[model samples]
Target: MTTRINAVPRAVPAEEVEVPFADCYITTAAQHAALRVLRSGWLTTGREVAAFEAEFAGYVGAGHAVAVSSCTQGIELALRSFGLPRGSLVLTSTMTFCGAVQAIVHAGLQPVLVDVDAGTGMPTPATVRDAVRAYGPPAAMTVVHWAGDLADVPALAEAAGLTLDQIVVDAAHALGTSAGTTPIGSQCAATCFSFYATKNLPLGEGGMVTTNDPERSRWLHQARLHGMTADAWRRYLPGGSWRYDVAEAGLKANMTDLQAAMGRAQLTHLPAWQHRRAQIAARYDTLLAAQPGIALPHRPALGTGTHAWHLYPVRLAPGIDRDEVIAELAQRRVGTSVHFIPVHQLTYFARIASVPPAGMAGADTLFGQLLSLPIHPRLTDGQIDAVCAALADATHRQFTRKGAS
Candidate 1:
């Protein structure tokens, strides 16, 4: 008798799942913290914000953490703190949310878009060198940790022939990420994190900047407000004088006490939440491993660091219409999203930089193939299986249609 083997059956959903591309995980403790802040009668930046800053600083192992209104503001403030000359060129990845480039432009600096590695959708040291060769040396560089995967900042700086102080990190997706015994926030000159609703540590809306430089930390605090010598909490509280003076022009980017309270509560649950995220990612990997025309997200090398798994993005093989697949998943009640369109492809940046479509081949190719799947603490195992089943069915149908045509 001939030996026989059968492929394992893929799990199908018992019923349709209304999976969303992103969802905020809110706990009862977070709700209580928000209520406590509301009952305290102080809503703006105050004691809660201070405590949150300290707690976050300790969590990330940074010497100082400054709470801000958003990650964009944090990036702008960090860049401004460097005091780079007006119209200075800043190097940044094109495969990002565009906020970093926007921050650079808002800070009176020019942005030089660097292409990313196609495999990882993140800029490598080689790409950094290419950008430098094409656009000349930059006054500063902002490295984005795409999809919670940490980039070797030290190596990138070395490739660009710049110092650590000249490097800033846009770690919006990497709050819990680490690099072989070293956390992300403490490595660069300034590392900025987001607490946007869809982020790993959701606070609805908030951001933080971590730095070891005391002077820069102090400057960020003053600059987040009105560049005043003293904030309202300092001057209006008990034994606080009404005396203050303007130091410099600053933007109002302070995080409110309400957001800080929720952040503090959410921070406590981050480790567990991160664990769930990993579990979801692993499930996705196992379910999609045998599916043709689908490539799972790239993972960093073992012992390199831990991934935060903020977004479970996968790439579709060429000749498949990504939009059609997205529509099919939507019809099946499985929501999906594209991570980003290359910033260099945006009209404004394209006009300013005058880069052709073929200039950044890596980012361009990745953009066409990328699709973000649902990955959060709130997702159930069944929902993950449903997502994979829907995706496999959608791609198989596309392949069938192509062959028929």
Candidate 2:
């Protein structure tokens, strides 16, 4: 099955009930920041880039942050930074986006897929332990914070017999999330964040890797920009030297000043945006909970962690075709999305890893029933109501009256 990044479009694009599945919450601050970057004349990596890096690192409580082109690049950089030998085992979640798995393969490591917890859509200590037991110790592992709910990394690491340094967190959905006292980026070897247009901190396109190791930070800083000793920020200064040396060969995944400016503005307003997202998700929980044959997102127990609510996913009961319902909802002009098709089920990975859907019990079960409702900061109360009403109607038409018009 093909994956659609945004929700499938409505048949006629309903005027009465048009709600997008995701919308970037941009404000005047972001506009002005972009304008400033445009007028600055020095558009590539510059002062704005440095400031955004510092501010994002502070927000996530990480020691250092290196801005990159996208979450995809950040993951690849994190894996490549480890310098693991070729064909080394790298276990990761089967429920996550393809980027994590792609990064492992691109880094010349063999990916061993692990099933996720059906409740949280995260690989558990048991799952990791089982994979490690089957595959033997891996050189490293990547844990994805699915739908902004963080996995208990320490527990997972211990269960898998690996140290913190051997783990990289795919935190694309978990910018502000935490587990107990530890935030997402601060605990892992390196945590990668996305600033995609629809992300919590939307900047059109960008990413950041946060880590405690200064050496790794320095390496990533250079590694993102073709291993140049000093970025244009330093090289373009009046006293800056044009002569620079390549410390190591690296990928061209550096974030531009323009993107950094918008990101900085988004970062400033993130707390408010997050609060709004939570409110929207709460409305979803209340709206969808009373109905039978549907499962809401499994929220983390209070004080255990915070949910970023990047996507509000629900699983339909058995016998309901998830795609049919999604199409029905789109007919009502209410947008919906699927968080993922198990990476193992996608044609490319299925061909490479060659794991049948039945092999990953949790992932297979979740994939069949998954659908993400319209959830974002820009959704109005009436829009939320329309979404819920459309869902209720879709269920009624699809299941309660199966053969009826």
Can you tell me which runs of candidate 2 are displaced by over 4 Å? 1-15, 354-358, 402-405
Residue lDDT tens for model 2, 30-73 = 88889998998989988888999999999989999999999989
Model 2: residue 113 alpha-carbon error in angstroms: 1.0
RMSD for each of the candidates: 5.8, 5.1
- Span of 10 residues, lowest total lDDT, candidate 2: 1-10
The candidate scoring highest on TM-score is 1
Native-referenced Cα lDDT, model 1:
0.88
Assess each prediction's global lDDT (C-alpha) against the native: 0.88, 0.83
lDDT of 1 by residue, 145-186 (tens): 899987888888887888999998999999878998777898
Candidate 2's TM-score: 0.93
